[model samples]
Target: MSSAPKNEIFTQVVLEVFKVGGLLNIDGDKLTKEFGLTASRWKILGAIMLSDNPVTVPEIGRYMGQSRQAVQRLVDVMAKDGLLTMTENPNHKRAKYIQMTTKAVDIYKQLDMKQVKWAEGLSSDLSTSEMESALKVLKHIAKQISA
Candidate 1:
């Protein structure tokens, strides 16, 4: 309850969050490697998949909490690889909307399956309530950090 102890606890929690982020990055790359996706590519794909409609690169960037330029470069490479296609945006003239190709959708599905298995294995020792509690804490921290 003392200020110093509270500060130490906050510092420790922040350090743990950073540690978890680094580990998750490595895990994400490893899990997506077989699907020819890196963590970045997989993340963009996920953003697109979760979008309500085909979205512009800027929108994707916003959704992913990344820069538009970074998302645009990734979109260009993905388009070249035939994972997605850019179409003229009805809402915006210069900015085009991105949509996944069938190939991309199939790949996403495979990735989702892999994620399910990977998560199950990782959470095998943790109870559902524990996982939920952790999720809540993380989400709260994320909201605070963003704010």
Candidate 2:
């Protein structure tokens, strides 16, 4: 690709990604609110559930590209809300590992079903090939930017 055209495409992709992110956040908030959760809270719960083992607040912050203090405060609230529980981490004395409660597991299952339905409806007009291409491009851009 020519430099000018490539730059223009990059700019357009960046703008579109930002717009998509905003829209997803809006959708997330609406979807999660039905279950007494916000996007952020839901996301934190997902992080713990998705992990193979219990994760620390700092580890979650890194995974979510957020600050440790911010994640810590959110985790505390979630713990208080009975959505998460903290356990002693053998690796770190001060940094406790966070685990999801049974209630959280049930909620996440419901959320996952909702997400599947929402995604299927939203992508009804798009072909699998197109979705794969978009995913590839987005992953490439994410790696580049993160690096």
Candidate 3:
């Protein structure tokens, strides 16, 4: 017996998703370039800011679908640069709580505003319902893959 033909349409859509991810990274780098931030740094910083409290490097890795070692390397460098601070975690002796410094908060706020405006401009020609549907579909796909 032979397997059925592959889903060409789904494959094409998946490829588009990959392409869009690359474009988003490029645009993110451009937005953060003036703030002395790269796409990687901005993502990690944004993760901490969005958490609204201290989190561990492992937590950030899980949230971003990255490796804990990769997050640790970035966190260590950021801490040295004074953008991140480490506090003792009562629950885990080895896992320190990570938080953004005041300076990093200021930069994050500025970038957040820029990101809002950029998103607005990009979605201006699109319908809100369409955007919502697209977001739902993309998130569903992500959830499926991660599961």
Candidate 4:
């Protein structure tokens, strides 16, 4: 691609990312509204669940590109809701390690099933190779943009 077209495509990609992000949030809200959860909360659950070991609010915040205070606030609420539990962080006095409660694990599993089916339907028309290529490009762009 020439410089001109490349720049245009990049700009379009960024705009599309924003558009798709909003739509995803809307769909997520609709999907989890019955459980009184939002997309951001769902994301935190996902991050903690996907971690190899228990994670801290700060770590989850960084993973999700959010603020520690925000993650902590959400964690507090989740804990009260029985969706998560916090234990003392051996490595840090203040930063507690967060883990999902059994309730959260069950919900996460259900959500994962729904997400897989939703994603499959959304990507039905797209080829695997093309989707993978787009993912590669998006990752590259995100890295560059974050840096």
Candidate 5:
């Protein structure tokens, strides 16, 4: 019988990651659906909310590891829905700054509360330190991958 290559270990890890990612995506979708939002839209809103200043579509896209065009489409949809507004960007005439509207802020707050509850429910067994450690590990892995 032929032996599996050592690199197969890395391949298996990646496959498992993808599988878990799909499950997480489904859970995220269900959570966003409850707020009448999609995962992409929520991510955009989150990026804006966490930012210290108004951000451009490209900035949000880069932060989310998505394409500019994809982020622009979401920006357009949200703008049309009165969830966000696009203002002129002095830094880049070609790019517009995105800002959340009051209604969007309200929705975001509600979603934030719901997210907290969901996390609490899901992580009832995990201590706060454990969660922090997991986050730190994930961030480290993400930085390594990006590098």
Candidate 6:
């Protein structure tokens, strides 16, 4: 067989990154399940919590890089579960703004605590400076890939 191309190394790196991301997600999902939340629903709750203003479903979809319908479904389920509330959007008659409920807010706080512990365990050996540098490099790579 012919020798592998130089670009194959980059491809292999990307694949490994995705593989690790998937593993992280699986662990996250297990944690979320303990709170009676799915991975996607927890992600929506997180987005809402991080936003200072009410976020539209479409805006959430765009931020999460998911389809609008998929985000809407998550919103609907959360609303039904009393985890979120939907308000009419004045800017868009058809669109609704989503906000987390008090229950969700409380749960999010618990999740945050768990996440802190998880981070501590995962980076037990890494210094803050190392973590910062890693974050910077990942951010740069994300920007380049998105661009």
Instruction: Write down the lDDT of every candidate, Cα atoms only.
Output: 0.90, 0.90, 0.91, 0.90, 0.88, 0.86
Q: Can you write out model 6's per-residue Cα lDDT over 37-111, one digit (the tens) per residue?
A: 977887898888888888999989877778999999889988999999988988999888999889999989888
Residue 34, candidate 6: C-alpha displacement in angstroms: 2.0
Candidate 2 worst ten-residue window by lDDT: 1-10
Model 2 TM-score on a 0 to 1 scale: 0.91
Clash counts per candidate, in order, are: 0, 0, 0, 0, 0, 0
Which has the greatest TM-score?
Answer: 4
Q: Largest lDDT belongs to which candidate?
A: 3
> Candidates' TM-scores?
0.87, 0.91, 0.91, 0.92, 0.85, 0.85
Tens-place lDDT digits, model 2, residues 42-125 = 889888888887799998997887899999998899889999999999999999989989998899999999999999999999
Cα RMSD (Å) between model 6 and the true structure?
Answer: 3.4
Q: Cα deviation of 23 in candidate 6 (Å)?
A: 1.2
Clashing pairs in 2: none
Off by over 4 Å in 1: 1-4
* Every candidate's CA RMSD: 2.2, 1.9, 3.7, 1.7, 3.5, 3.4
Query: Which of 3 and 6 is the better model by TM-score?
Result: 3
Candidate 5: tens digits of C-alpha lDDT, residues 72-124: 99999999999999999988998999999999999888889988998889999
Error of 1 at 70 (Å): 1.7
Worst 10 residues of 3 by lDDT: 1-10
How many clashing residue pairs are found in candidate 4?
A: 0
Where model 3 places Cα greater than 4 Å from the true spot, the runs are 1-6
Greater lDDT among 2 and 4 belongs to 4
- By TM-score, is 4 or 6 better? 4
Worst lDDT run of 10 residues, candidate 1, spans 1-10
